[model samples]
Target: MVTLKQIAEELGISITTVSKALKEYPDVSKKTRKLVRETASMLNYKPNSFAVNLRTRESKTIGLIIPVIVHHFFSSVIKGIIEQAEKKGYLVIILQSNESYELEKKQVDLLLSKRVDGILISLANGTADFKHLNDVIENETPLVMFDKIAKMVKCSKVIIDDRKASYKATQHLIDIGCKRIAHFRGPLLPQNSIDRFLGYKKALLDNGLEYDSSLVYICECGDMSFEEGKLNAQKLLKEHKDVDGIFINTDLVAIGAMTEFMKQGVRIPEDISIVGFSNWFMASVISPSLTTINQPGLEMGINAFKLLYKEIKKKKKNSDFSFKELVLDTDLVIRESTKN
Candidate 1:
């Protein structure tokens, strides 16, 4: 905890001289700057970020809120955000809402209280109200949403074409001769989930296949866990014996359903074909490898932070800027889970 006063006293210079020298101000001689920097380094002196922020009116930090932490896609997103933020000399403060609306609201409040320069968020599954989000805008903070987002909120967003991606997934199943295709959709609240479900249904009808409500399973808890997938698989088996294919919302859930089907003596692609979303790493290593939609999590993160950074700069300059909606692309990776 070395202080500027201590460094100044050691150098027998005024505190102002020491501060300016450390900052490499032109008013201080280059020799003095070099000496002050060397001495500061030797003393392991660290500048107080709070004091620097107060002087510049910028925290040099941003807040990031996500729905999950252990998820592969989200982890990749985090890495991209951190890498990009570091390049811009900014730090990220990450918080997980764990899919709870209340927690998401509170986390927003916490970041606002800290007076972060900007915020990037992927809304929680249970988030239906936008008051907390609107509060950030009302406070004139730069905000960007990625992945799961609310359309009515006036902010920049980074996301993929969920409906189009899901349509491709479901159409692939239909193309492979899956006449009776079922769906394991995410919770109803998130726009991505709703769009994905719509895509699945539209694909069925477009291909002259019947869309059955009974075949559509919902993850009521909104966690979209492996256990939920397994439970849905069990329910599907009991309720609809004719289903020959399924389009799952996530890779983990698809793997869980695959595991369940295998245990029940059902052969993948032979008895039933499956397609999942998100293209998680486990999708490739699993027993028949899963066919999935490749959501660009890393690219999403990079673009999200880039948008937030731009908005932050604009806000700082008091420049008028238009909100942007960036939709990244998605691809369907064909694997052994589906018929060739």
Candidate 2:
């Protein structure tokens, strides 16, 4: 009920000054801004978001599109985004694409219609064509991509070195007495998947190990549920009985594969060793805990939002903005899944 005008009257300041202070405009002194914020808080003065948005033409909101929500990595990323967005008084609109290109396109359209200030996304596996994303770019909507992104998207990006990480995982297995290693790779579409596969292949070539095509199998799905992992594990065991190690695409799938291996009387780290990407919580709990790549989900999310905010500010100022490609680091965690 209390208004900025009342605060201005009480402080004997102009309403324009009060408004500028509340918005943290550079024109206002820091001392004045602090007093205005404190007074507003004391008065419980909740600005009418709709009215303010109508005036500024900015919702003070951002959209985030992810491939899935039930995933531990994605969940962590969401938490990071929410925490970071809150600091700037920005609200987040989260949407899941279910890894479908059509669904992803729909989500983008929905966010655009909502008139959010900016968007952050992790592209779905099924997304190959950039037409829908380009539409957002053409519309001058600030966009930032994280994790699963396309190199051709021409937007700000936050990601780890998937290829290098995968290579280290494979090499670790080989160093620990693993021979005839197999790979459980994601689908060929997503850039990370392709990079991981290439990394695995390169490690094999570097180690003078045979790069056997028969040893590699695709393990991808909407949620990357346990079934796909188990099925691929079964397939790998049945066809490549001599395989002593596996580099799986994700922790969920890797855990599933481990389950199948256990049921089939395979001894983990003794008969076979496995490593996975994205060190989900389940990785540490599973028997013979998974030794995997620790992808920085929180960092990726925070970085994505930071980049989105920068673009949003630039767009608002009608300033020239260049793309930022931020690459974070990954760690190879050694655990019970691998022989020490």
lDDT against the true structure, per candidate, is 0.95, 0.92
Model 1 gets an lDDT of 0.95
Q: Show the colliding residue pairs in model 1.
A: none
Q: Write the per-residue lDDT of candidate 2 for residues 1-340, one digit (tens) a residue.
A: 9988999988889999999999899999999999999999999999888888999999999999999998999999999999999999999999999999999999999999999999999999899998989989998999999999989988999999999999999999989988899998888799998999999999999999999998888854545778889999888888988999999999988998999999999999899999999999989988899999999999988999999999999999999999999999999999999999
- How many steric overlaps does candidate 1 have? 0
Query: Lowest lDDT 10-mer window, candidate 1?
Result: 220-229
Q: Which stretches of candidate 2 lie over 4 Å from their true place?
A: 1-46, 220-223
Cα displacement (angstroms), candidate 2, residue 284, comes to 1.2
Best candidate per TM-score, number?
A: 1
In model 1, how large is the Cα lDDT of residue 277? 99
lDDT of 1 by residue, 286-312 (tens): 889999999999999999999999999
Per-prediction TM-score, please? Answer: 0.97, 0.87
* CA RMSD of each candidate after superposition: 1.3, 4.7
